[model samples]
Structures are given as C-alpha cells and as structure tokens.
Target chain A: METPCLVMDADLMEANLHTLQAAVNRAGKALRPHAKSHRCSRIAHRQVQVGAVGICVAKLREAEVLALSGITDILLTGPVADSTRLQRVPALLERAPHLMLVLDSHETARILHQSLAAHNRSLDILIDLDVGLHRTGIPPCDAVSFARALAAFPTLRLRGIQAYAGQVQHIRAFEERRTASLTCMKEAGQTFESLRRQYPACTIFTGGGTGTFDIDIEIPALTDLQAGSYALMDADYRTVQSRGCLTPTHTFTPPLRLLTTVIGTHHPSHVTVDAGLKTMYRDGASPVPAEPEWSHLSYEWFGDEYGRLLTPPGTRRPRCGDRISLYVSHCDPTVNLFDAFNMIRAGSPAETWPIDLRGCSQ
Target chain B: METPCLVMDADLMEANLHTLQAAVNRAGKALRPHAKSHRCSRIAHRQVQVGAVGICVAKLREAEVLALSGITDILLTGPVADSTRLQRVPALLERAPHLMLVLDSHETARILHQSLAAHNRSLDILIDLDVGLHRTGIPPCDAVSFARALAAFPTLRLRGIQAYAGQVQHIRAFEERRTASLTCMKEAGQTFESLRRQYPACTIFTGGGTGTFDIDIEIPALTDLQAGSYALMDADYRTVQSRGCLTPTHTFTPPLRLLTTVIGTHHPSHVTVDAGLKTMYRDGASPVPAEPEWSHLSYEWFGDEYGRLLTPPGTRRPRCGDRISLYVSHCDPTVNLFDAFNMIRAGSPAETWPIDLRGCSQ
Candidate 1:
C-alpha cells in the first residue's frame, strides 16, 4: 500500500526454484535449497514441493519454522550446538521426523548423544568440512578423527561430509573461480571418500552455490549443491564468473525491486526519499534505480531515514511525488526488513506473501 | 518465546524521558522527541505525557501512527507526499488540531497547501535546514526564502525552522564534539536569528541528541533538543563522551538490551547466538554481552540468523542452554526488526510489548 514494501517477483521466484532444481537434476546430485535467502517458511515449502532433496537452514530455530511448515527433510547447515540450542532439537525433531544437522566439534557430538540418550536414537549428522572458508567447519583431514570421536556418541550418526565453497561464490575471475571451486570441492570429496571407507554407508557430500553449480556438476563426488540467491538475482550475485562453469551473470532475471517515493526536493540538484538504510541494505553496493531515466541521480547515504540522491547535472530531477524503483545491493537482509511482500506479476499486485518466518530472527 | 527478544527497560526509559525534559527545561527549548528511534505509538504517547513540546517523525505514515495515538503535538520531520498518507494528515489534524508538518521542497509545500486549501484550512510548516551533516535540509541561508516561498499558499503557515544536528550526536570526542556542536548549531542559530531580525516571531530553534544532550543545555537560544536515543541507550551511544558535561551518563543506564539464548555452541572455543544482523544494527558499533563475564567473547558478522561470537582463548565455554544477553549496537533499526519486545525488568519473565509500529518502513 505504501513505498518500501518488498516486491517479490513470484514468476521469477519459481524460475529460480526450477533453475536450482534443473542444475541438481542435470548433475545427478541432490537439491537442498538454502532457506536463508527468502527466510519465509512458505518459500521453503515451495522449494520442498518443487522436488528439493532437502532444505538447509542456518539455525536450529529456522529449522523449526520449516519443519512446522511440513518439510520433513532439512539440514541445519551450521554447527549443531550442545549446551546452547540443543534444547530446541528434540522439539524440532518431533515436529519434523526426518531432519539432518551439521556437527563441527567433538563436544557437540558428545552433548547431543548424551542429551538425547532417553530416545537413544542417532540423529542424522553431517561432519562440516572446512575446505577454505575460515568462518566455520573442521579441516578436511580432521574429519575422520572428529567422526570417530563423534561415533562415541552412539546417538549421533556421522552421515556424510559437507564443504561449502563460499569464497568462490562471488568470484569475478572465471578461470580462477573454477580452479578454486574444484580445489575446494576436491578436498571435500576426498574427505567424503575417506569417511565412506571408514563408515561403509556414507552417502551425502554436498556443497557449491550459484557460482559453482556448473563446475560442481562435473566434480563426481559432491552429492548436492546448496544455492539460494539464484531466484532473485542481485547486483552482487550477477558478477559471479567461472571458466568452464555456469554463467551466473544474468542467468536469472532480477525480480525484486524496492519502490521508493521522493519526499524532499528543496535543493533542485538533490532529492530525498522515504527509504534509507532501514529500508535498504548498503553493505554490498549502492541501490540502483531500475530506470535509466532516474539516472544521473546517484543515491547518497544520509543517515538511517533520509537518502540525499544527487541528480545528474542537466538531467531530469526527481520531484516530491515521484516513485522511483530501486534494486537493493543485497537481497537477504533487505527482504528481512519487510513483514510481508507484494508478490507482483508483470502488471499488477498479485498476492501478498507475508514473510511468515519473519520475527523468527532467532 | 524465541531466543532473542528486544528487552526494553521501562524504568530506565522513563528516566531518559525525564533526562531530555530536564535538558530542554534548563535550556528553555521545546523538547520534541524524535519518534523515528522508537516508532512506537505507546512510546510517542509517553513522550507527549512527559512534557514534550511535540513528537518528531521521519515519515508521514509514522506521523499518522503517532497522531492516531491521540498525540496533539506532532512534527513530521521528513518531507512527505503520497496522497494516501497526505489524505490521512487532514483527518489526523481533525483529531490533533495543532499538528505540524516539515518539508524541504517547494513542491511539497505547494501540494500540502493545496491539500490544506482543499480542506479549507491552513497547515503549519517548518523548513528543514541542512546543517553540516549535509542531510535532508536546505542550506541554512535559504531557510527564510524556503519558508517565505510557502507564502504563496495562504493555507500554509510558516512555522519557523527545523535544524537537526545528527553528525554531532555521535562525536566520540567530548571537547571536540562540544565545539562541533556549538559550531553546527551556531550556523543553524544564525539562520533563525537572521530570519527573526526580519520576520520578528521565529519561535523554534531545535537540535541536539543523547551525545550532545547536556552540552545542548548550554545553548541558551535553543528552544528544544530533539533526542530519542536517550530512552534506549545503545553501544554506539555508550561511546558518546559526555565527560565534561553534567549530562550524567553514568546514571543514564540503557533502557534496551537484546536478550539472546545461546543457540549454537558446537564449536570448541566460541559459540553462536540466535541474533545476527537482523536483530542487531551494525551501522554504528558492535553488540556487547550484558553479562560482564562475556567480556572476553566478541560478536562477529555471522549470516542472517546467527552471530558468531569468539570465546576467550581457552576458557570454559558457555554451553547451549546458557542465556546470553546482547546489548545492541543501535536500538532503532534493531528494534524495527521485531514484531514485539519483551518489556523487561531486572529478573523478570517480560511482558510482551507489541512492536505495533514495525513493518511501517515507509
């Protein structure tokens, strides 16, 4: 009804869902769509219904939201906690019976095993292999020892190995990104192979994103690719390049756009909009107005509530009532800012998708 | 209940309300608490009850929210135009007869005056003066011409000027910030003085923040200081050096803190919480744990739903079930992310304060 309402392109969203599925289908790998992008349970449900092998959530609480939405197969991609959020596990597992979790430490394995002793059932666990991303996960070589240590926890099952190549996701160099992806996934693949020989029934080895979806298809070992942003392409994701890999650039049409209204025009050369940092994310890049007509005007940051966009010299200046459509620098947090989305088609407002999983920031 | 909830300290919030009142009372300035910080009608109502001259809002829709809350004195600080929102303004005026609107554009004044004429009445307006912050305000020198331009619309009443010193608010150095505040506000003061020498009845000279609250008390000409962060001091505001000023920062404790439960602790050295960029504002400063014990651990940028906190080198780590309290970097946007807050007291179950003003991004 007003400016700053998140506009989701449902048609493009479905296209993104299918695109990820198509990649997984061709690669003969599993499709586990990460829910971090949309964060909405309804979107996760759609991804599941569209033949995703599993949905990957970043937190245990997020896993709960998805599980409550009737998704049975899910992987809480981050390290599963023992003392911190493990209390939510049983309830979450009860909501959705078949759920998998990632483990990166021995203490976690011990805690989960001991905590769930009453059930005496091994939870589906995947050893998070740290290939290159220094953020989290264990080193690939340390995967076996950790798995053996985790085996002591009879209730925690070491299912497979997962190594996400995030560093290669935004690679601008084509050949460099391809080599980087293969090198990282190769280590993950080797870890999976070593673990499989030890466990005899190791099945899952998943990694790769929109950037490596094409290259990962050739790496015989990765079981699945977890890519999320492919649906609503952003300016940042549009730059992903890799030699012999999929062209992430312009592969998916950009669907989401923030419609903001010009509220101030005192300085003829400068205009202010109702949308500011609170309405958009500026961590990645400055928001670009969709139309080139709104060009010559560069959006400038003016605190949290005001944006002083500089109008190009001799260009058409924005008036007080003009509605300017802008593309957010990043998609995830920008979407998180809105409670509901105006899921629009080509012409009119179609359906209102309440970001149902909103305020579930936990 | 979720792991992370906005914990608003009502008692401290009340104190901050009084603090602003005292600052303005001493300076003989009108205290118009900016509603942009809280965005809650309940909070706006409280500010009105506590002798605030008016409530300053960033958006017309937000002004509508506060106006509907039965607040008679209101100031829509930012320029606004949507017919839907502007249409509501006249009706809002019906409830609160003394509503004031702010504008930076001649176009806004024209449209607003047109709307006011259509309603067969006049509306009061303040020309937003751009100070050193170089934000959504006209240059100080053009304050009168901008104010005088609205004279064509007989229905629009020129109600002095609105100059907000946002840059001086976060000046971390005490003496330097004090000097900068004087210089910035002096520039704004000169505009009001020059206009008054010509027009005679220039009534308001408003500016100041939590950072310059006590310092603003020294500006004898300032009619009122518009500060909202005092109600909920944050990590960024915590660094506001008010050493020389009698503004009593030691006693002015923060009214807001994010209560987060340890969600992920599978890692050995560090742990992860359920709050991330979505629950915390990263623009100003980093979040800190409320507990003094967590001093060793620092929060890092974890993806959407998780905050990766590094633990003290080799200490006995906090377990999964541990409840860690997080002081948000900035209260405004962090509070905007939630649908509700836990109106918390020291050692309390917390009453749910519905963030009724949330999702009002426009």
Candidate 2:
C-alpha cells in the first residue's frame, strides 16, 4: 500500500478479461489464461468467472499453489524433470483433480508415469511440439511416437499437443508477427491432425501468448489460447503492433503499474526513485513513467534499489516525496518480485491480493 | 530440496566470509556485510560470527526482517520516501535499537523527524553524499547545509556521511575501480571533515561494495566496509579483476548456484532446462553451467520458465532429467526470487536457510 508496490487497476483489468475472452469465444476457441503472469488466484478466479475454461501454469510449484488456492483446473505448460518435483504432481492432482502436464521426451514421460503409478493416479499429458521456438517440445515428426509411448503408460492419459511460439510473440511488425505465428500454428495444426488420426482421444491443443492471441485465435489448430499478459499489459507489450496495425492498438490497457516515490533529487539533471531492478523487472526494457507530464523523463537503472529519472532541459523535474506510477517493461517477472498486489478500484486503494506463487519456482 | 532451487556451498561461503572479514580487519575497518545480497539472516548471522560489526539492508522491510531474525545492528542504506514506510521505521527501531537510516534530502528528514517525534524516539541518520553514482544522495557542496537542516531536528541524530560509489563496484579494470573509489572517498572525506568540525559525534562513515571492498578498506575516510557480494561472488563480480591480477582471483568462490534439470531434449544441438530468467536473476548476464563437462554449452533465455543450453558440435549433450548447477549472474536479485536456500555442506544436502527478506522491498 506504499511506494514501490505493484498496483492493479480493476476497471482496466476487467475490460481486458472481457475483450479477450469475447474475441476467443467468437473464434470458437477456449481461453485458458496463463496464471504465471499475475500469479494471483483471485485474478485467476476472475478469469474463470469471465468464461475461461481453465488456467495454465508454468511450474509444478505454481500448480500446487493454485490448486491449494482452490483452482481445480490447471494445465502445467512446462515440463517437470526433477524426481522431487515430479513426486509432488500426484499430490497436486489430488487437490486440483483436473491437472494436466506437458511432456516432450520419453524419459520425462517415464518419470512422470512412475511417480503417478506409485500414487495409483493418472494425469492428463500433452505432447509439447517444437514450433520454431526451438526452446522446448518434441518435433512434429516424433509426436506420434511420443504420444504412443506416453499412452502406453496406464498412469498417463494422452492429451493433445502444446506448440508455443514464444520468440515471435513480441515481433514489432504486425505482418511479420502474423506470418510467424501462422507458420508455427500451421505446423502445429499439421502435427495435431496427425496425432488426432493416430489417437482420437487427443482433443486439447493449447499455445500462444498475449502477443499473438488474436492471430492464434484465428488458427483452427489451437483449441484454447494461453494469453497471460493481455490482462496486465506492460511497456514492452505495448510496443507490439496488432495484425495489420502499424501502431499499438491499445486493445488492452496497462492495468498493472509500479508505484514509486522520488527519494533523492541531488543532481540538476536527474532524480532517484525508490524502485529499481530489485523492485521492477528489468528484462526486455527499462520502466517508463506512466504520467503524461513526466513523459520526457527517461528512466535508468541507478542501482538495485534506486531508479534514476533523467530530467531533460526545461522538463518539469520531480521533487522528493512525489509519488509516480511506472509502466513496467515486463509484468510477469515484475509481479514475481512482490508478495502482494495493491488493488486499486475507482481511483483508490481497494484491497491487497497475495501473489500466492511469488517464490513458488522450485 | 529440489532442482531449480538456489544452492549455496557452505564451505566456499565460509571461506569467503573469513577471507573478506580478515582483509577488512587487517586494514583497520569494520565489516558490515550487506544482507541485500543473500537476504538470509542465517548467512548474516554467520558473517557476524566471523567479525561483521553490523549489517546493511536496502529497505525498511529488509531491516524489519533482519531485526526479527536477531540482527540488532542494521543500517538501512536506502531512503524511505512514503509516509507509510516512514511510519514503520519506529517499529523497526524498537526491534533494532541500533538501527540507522541514510537520508539525502531535508524533506525526508522532516518526515522521519515527524514520525519518530510522535514515538519520543530518535534515529541515527547518515547524510548520503553523491559519489558520482548520481543515483541517491546530496552533492558534496550541499552536504553541510543538509546535515545542518537534519541536525536541527531533535528526533534525528546525525551519525556520519554515506558515500557509495555503486557505479564503480563492477568496473573490470582494477586501477579504474580503485581510482574512481578513491576520488569519491576523497570528496566524502572533505565533507566528513567539514561535518566533523561542526558535530564531532559523526563517526559512522560507511560505503563500498564487494568489488571495491579491498580498495575501500584502505581509504581512511571509510570507517566500515559494506561489502555484500564478497560472501557470495557472482558471475558479474567474478569478472572484476583485482588490483594487478589479470584473471578473476578466487577472492570468493561462487557459492550460490541454481540447480536445474534438463526438461526437454528434442533438438540434438539444444536442450531446455527448468530454470530461466524467473528462477535465476538476469540483471548482469545469463547463467552458465557450473560443471567443466558442460562448459562448452552456453546458456540462453528460452522463456520465463525455461533456459536453453546450446551444445555445439563435440560438446557433451545433456539428456532429459540430467540435473546440473548453474552459476547465477547476480546474487542479490536471484536470491530474492527464492523462499529459501538449499545449503550444501560437504557435498551433501544440508539444512535450509529461509531467505527471510526475499521480497522485503517495500
């Protein structure tokens, strides 16, 4: 409830939820909002209330936390390799009952099967396919064999495939992003079709993030869209152009922001704020001042705990104790830095939501 | 306890504690290790046991966490701007009777005085001076006036000057780092001399990080060294060359690491690990494989939850489920991402130490 805290605009977030869900529904696809972005079960519940089929998490710990928070439906998009983490999956399944995991290799499948077999439980498994990201997933050529191998295990039920083109999610050019996303979706569609022929039981096909959700919704291959950042857009995502659009369409308002107070004004050209890399995520870009009056001032990383705002000549300089909202470069990692979100509704502080999965990365 | 958790080598960390503390002591300076680096009170307690006179924290929340963990002497190196945060300072002072805060402006001093005056308590205040970082702190020319303004408040006790040259802490050239640190120290010394002439009670002159701890210990102006990274060297600090050393001298072995498991091995040239920017800090650089066998494999950010290891021809390829330790790029932010440290002792799993101040960045 103070400076350097994560602030969420309830109205803007609600608009994002309704708009994106409506778009996905119009495209005849389900929306499984990725909880890794906000990491708040309250937000996830809101997404579910807005007509989300389920939620997707990136780690077992995230799944466990969401499950404990009473989120019964969860699809873990990332693979769990360590035996200790794999062992926890069955326990999570008992709580969330509708938990599904994504797998890429036979070795991981074997481990998951063994762990679930010991618990006398079965888990839904999705074959992750490599769709030009070259990050994770098995190749489409190997999808059939991988699915068959996973299906052989009685403790595992073969779901569809997961092809996420994360690298192309933030392409600046609208046509370029659309082309890249369509190409990957086409490949994933071919793989899903091949797998569907082999095992008719395969139905769930999920992938795509906030950057390509609109494009992905148009793809018949993706059964559900896993867009996480749309609800709380950041500075980096705001730069991305929509399909056939040259500039950011403002389809989603940046609901999440970092509230910081000016702590020092030692130099004539710069002032220091309380939030820096430690409080805000510094992956894609530096945070920008959200106020229109401070648009000329550029933000720079002063230290781990301080951010320096470069005041150009003739620009209105910030004074000590002045509070300002900063649009973060990235939202997911920034949300992970804090323990709770100071929710703002109707222009005032409403309530605080715990980032239940804040440090649940193990 | 599990893969993707932060691991600390106890032996290496202990050696670093003794070596750095002995170095500072030999130079006739007290060591107040910065808890922002590890955020674990157990490690801070170990540093105190090895001769650290006090500890340095970056936020009021961190001060409260450390004080609750029984670390009574704490110097909060960052300024608190918000009224809500300033009000918490008195509560922290109750827990940490020897609590000190750094201030840069008169506005902040007045706020602190007003808050503390209500509780009939006085706090030790250090005038933060600009040491070329231009991040936080008053310029040397304004130091005397600022100190006088702060001394006018009965609730505030002017302790000394805090001149931290944070920018020069990671300079690759040893002479460059030393020269920059010395130049700042000289200016600070001049300011301290001026302040001492008026108030002889000013004695606690502190500033300098791990990169310049040896250089700072030699500066007569600095009464104590605030070296946090010395106890747990990171990949970025390891690149800092000593006074005349060409390569990184093992002043401190990188005791902290992230243990990740190979979760996907679809491509022959690349494999995906469970830890990425989310699990490991990505401020200074990307994490590298710790083992010699995987030295040829370079690490890259695959996504939020996955790290891609690029294995060139002739390099040993990792298979799915193979766990390896990764040397983190930065220790402070990386440690802040975890709830606890999986401390390794004598090549075995040891006791866990909670990162008590992991998200204590209010």
Candidate 3:
C-alpha cells in the first residue's frame, strides 16, 4: 500500500457496526448511518446489511452516488438551496425513488417544488428544525408554520422532522453532553409531536448522533438515528467519555487508520511524515499515533504535504522508510481528502474501497 | 455558477501574472510557479505563457497530471520517500524528460535510485536543505555530505538544491518577514556554494514562494523563484504586507472568489450559506464577503456543509436565495476541494477550467 492513504481494519469496523446496530435495534429505533462520514457505497451496503433502515447524506451529489450504487432509501440531511443543484434532483429520483430531502427554508422548498413539478414528480421532505445548532433549519418554534407553508407545494410531501444537534457531538463531559443533547431533542420532540398531530405521513423523527446515541434512543419521538462516526471511529470522539457508558465499555474502536511514511528524521525534535493538512484535514484535534510504542510523540501540521511528529524525551524516533499508523482527528473531512481506503482483514489486505462520494459538497 | 464553487477573474489573474513575472524577469531569475496552488493545467499553461520557465508541484500525482497535460519541465518539490511511489518515476520521466524530484534522505534516494536502475534510467534530483522549517530536508551543514552520498548512486543526477522558507511566509510585518527569509536563504546559499564546487552539475538553486519570492530573488544563488499563490491571491496572503510591496501597491489582487448561496435566513443574528469546512477549507484566515456593502458581517464555520455570516448592528442581512462572493481563506486546500474553476472574463462566463489535479495528494 502507498503512504498517505486511509487504511481500515475491516474486522474492527465490522465489530463497530454490530455494536452500534445492536444498541439502536435493542432500543427499537431505526439506524440510518450517515454516508457523509465514509463516502464509499460499499460501506453503506454493509451498514444496510447490518440492519440500517437507510443512509443519510449531506449533499445531493452524495445521494446521487449512493442512489446509483442501488441504495434506494437515502435521506439527504442538508438542504439543496440553489437552482443549479436543484436540477440534479429529478435525475437522482429516477434512480432512487425512495430518496428523501430536508427543507429548512420555504425559498428552497419553492425552488425544489418548481423543479420537481416540471418533471411531474413529488419529493418526500422533512422539516429541518433548528435544535439550538442554528447552522441550518427553521426555529423549533416555527415547525408548525413551516409545515403549513410546505402544504402549499403540491410536489412536496410532508415527512417528519430532522433535528440534529451537531454542536453537542464533541462535548468532553458525559453529563453535560447528555443534558445538552436531551434538552435540545426534548424541545424538538415537542415540536415533532405537534407536527405529527397535523400530518398523517409525518412519522419519521430522525436525528441524534454517536455522541448522545444512548441518551437519544430513549426518546420515544426519535424513530431513527443518523449516527455516522460510530461505524469508523476517530480520535475526536474518544474524548467524550459519555459515549462509552454503554454495556461494553468503549464499544466503538477506531477502525479507520491513516497510514503515513516518515520522509525526514534529520530534525532532533521531530520527524516529518508524508501526511499533512492536504492528506489529513486540519479541522479537529491533532491525530494521534495508533501504536502504543510511539504514544509519547504528538502530530503537528508541517505544511500542505508534510506533518511532523515531535519526539518527547525517550521517544523512539521513526526512520525515513518507517510507516506510522494514526487515528485521524476527524473522520468526515479527512475522508474527503483521499481517493480510497485500504481495507485490512485479519492483518492482511482485503480490498480497496473507493471513496465514491468524495468532493460531493455540491 | 454553482454555489460554493471557485470563480477566477481571468483579467485580474492575468495582471497578477504579468506583474510578478515582470518582477522576476527584471531580477534576472527564472520563475517556476508552483502548480499546487492552482491544480488546473490550463492555469499552468497560462503561467508558462506569462514567462514562467517551468512549474513546481508538491506531489508525484500532481506532476503526473501536469505532465500529461504537456507540461514537461516539472519539479516535484516534496520528497517521494517510499518504494511504491519511487516506482512511478520512470513512467513520469517518459512523459516529462526534465522532471526533477527533491531528495531529503539517503534512504529515499537509495530506494529511488534502485527503482530507476531497474528501468535503466537516470533522474534529475535536487538536494532539499532544511531552512529552519524542520519539516523535510537535511540540515544545511550536511548538504555536502548528502551530495557526496548521492555521487555513489549512478541512476541519480545531482541537479541543484532547494531551500523553502515556509515558516516566514505568513509573517504579518514586512521587515520581520524579509529579515527571516533572507537569513534562511543566505545560509542555504552558502551551502549551495560549497556543494556547487563539488558537483559542477549543481546550477539551479530553486526555492522560495509567493511570500518570499521578492526577498529571495535578491540572493544571487537563487536562480529561480517557485512562487505559486500570487496568480490567485487569497485572504491569507492579503495579511502579508511584504508581498504587496512590489510595483503598484498590492499588485496581486485576489482574482479567486468563492461563490456561495444563502441557504437559511431563519436565525435573527446570522444567515447560513452553503459553504463550510468541506466547501472552503478552514486553514488560515476566515473568508470575507467580496461585496463592500456587506463588509460588516464575518464568517463562521457552521458545520461540514454550512457557514454562518453574523449580521452585526446596522448590517444588511442577506435573503435565503441571495448569492455571496467571498475571498477564500486559503487557496491550495480550497482549490483541491473543487473540481473546476468558473472562469469569469469581462463580467461574463469565459470557460470552466477543470481542476484536473485535484485529490492527487498521493
């Protein structure tokens, strides 16, 4: 395998999948693993085989890729606001008929309705409610009003609501993360209950993430969970101890590993590796070396094409040709940087899975 | 144009090209623009047309794309350390006869030489010297020793040395940046002088970037300047006042504009856009709205697929369907995210240039 590539331990990933799926199943709620984390359609298939109801994607392009891969049940979690992107909706619907979309603004819904109505089609859409994240979606107070507005569009079907509290996914403290996520979901659930009273087809209350999955599954309103990073964990999630309070402690181990080669070891304090901000993204916490022997060293961004590991006292410094496996800081953006992941099964090469939906931000 | 896509003003970019090329020409040094900033082959061809002798790339994959596009004199600026990547040298050489690679370690050089020896071919290599970056490259004191070691290999030819002062590129103050860059280059020049006497083939002393190109050209030993970002300036470069000290204050105008659509206007304090960390990379400075009328708002990363512009007091808020043009925070990583550049010429669509070398980090 080449340096600066993603390597996934398939056995560990399979174990992670079963653990998360079993937990969600035990709670009697559906699991729609977010495909935006791992853009590969193969993984989405595996998720479906492991009892995932459907998959969620962040963009229309991601939906197009997954839909082409024959996964019909896909919910696009983000809004398609512009006309250019709205043009792609009909073609994707032709492939995956069960596709659902989220709508935060009436302006976007109106444009999408116009586009879909031209093709003599109707799309199932969920009212995206702002659960304190405020990034997208309508305010929770205006859910009924937004749904009433959507009633005017004949080409759009009213589904349930999607209220993902993305802001609480990385909270370090367990009680705080629980309280924050529950408070937001509780308010969103109240709005969903009111919307459910009005719309008969509005049954799917999909939301929650890996961080508060245990707490969120207890919510009677949340019919399905859209947790992504649980399938292939990263270093960023390990900081949240609350996520590990399940039956088996720390059930989700990081299956996704970043394999990088050391290029220069001349510097006494640090060794430069082939992976940098370009190979692995720089949004989240710094990546940690996967091996226990090199735990003393810390990763730092050198440039676009190089990263350096600071060698603490008594740390074993890596040589030029030596390879270092690292747990990626963040999974989603880092996955977007690579073309494919080298799948390893039982410490051997299994297959290479293409990141099919990479650069699907459109 | 689509939302969250890169748009380059061709005329402004052409002016930036002419201004920098003229400066380097007057200094009697070759201008080898780095292709990593703008991975499009069309832009590389444009840079060559504007008097660039060759182009520099950070990865072997980037070189492959540019070489396939008929760019012959390409320099792979970063080291290709492992055997898997070294095996590609012969094939690249077949396309680009003058393709040069950087070498920082004897382990990588031996592996590369062995690979080339198998193909019965020789390669041009530049010894990378550490200029206080401590990322890649050998120490300046070990340049001659490294050169002597290279003489032991038959498949590798000693072309020159490369010393890039990446640390001083973003220094806000002009005098501080100038002093730091000159100090590093002077030390590197002394090393080059010693190595030049030992190896007569060592003529091309290529280094420097858009940040230190002006200061580095003053060093008589620096035969070529490998500046990249001047062609399409970003919000990060605008902070470096020294880069603007050339003829006609602020000679390089930011031709690259990130076009995004307002997705949600439900929040009272801010409006959300369709560009986030995934659309525009979150390294370096925050992107500013291109229009002067909305200058009061500042950008904040909302999530992976959305960004928020906080509407301050007396600020005119954008509607749901309004378009926003922003100066990207960073150019290289942001360019890698997009597949094409929506070229704008004379307030009209000129062409769509594919970012052919995107996701070529390997």
Best by lDDT: 3
Model 2's A-chain: what TM-score? 0.97
Per-model TM values vs. the true structure: 0.89, 0.96, 0.95
TM-score of 3: 0.95
Per-prediction DockQ comes to: 0.48, 0.73, 0.73
Candidate 1 on B279-334: residue-level lDDT in tens? 78677788877778887788776756667778876765777657778778888888
| Tens-digit per-residue lDDT, A1-362, candidate 3 | 87789999999999999998999999999999999899999999999999999999998888988998999999999887777788789889999899999998777888889999999999899988889898888888889988998899999999899999999988877778888999999989999899889898999999999888898999999999999989888888876775446332276889999998888878788888989888888876789999898888899888888898999767678887789999998899889988899999999988999999998887
Backbone clashes under 3 angstroms, per model: 11, 0, 0
Winner by lDDT between candidate 3 and candidate 2: 3
Selected candidate, larger DockQ, 1 vs 3: 3
Candidate 1, chain A: TM-score against the reference? 0.93
Candidate 2, superposed: residue stretches over 4 Å from native? none
Q: Against the true structure, candidate 3 has what lDDT?
A: 0.88
lDDT ranking of the models: 3, 2, 1
Model 1: lDDT equals 0.76
- Clashing residue pairs found in predicted model 3: none
Error of 1 at A256 (Å): 1.5
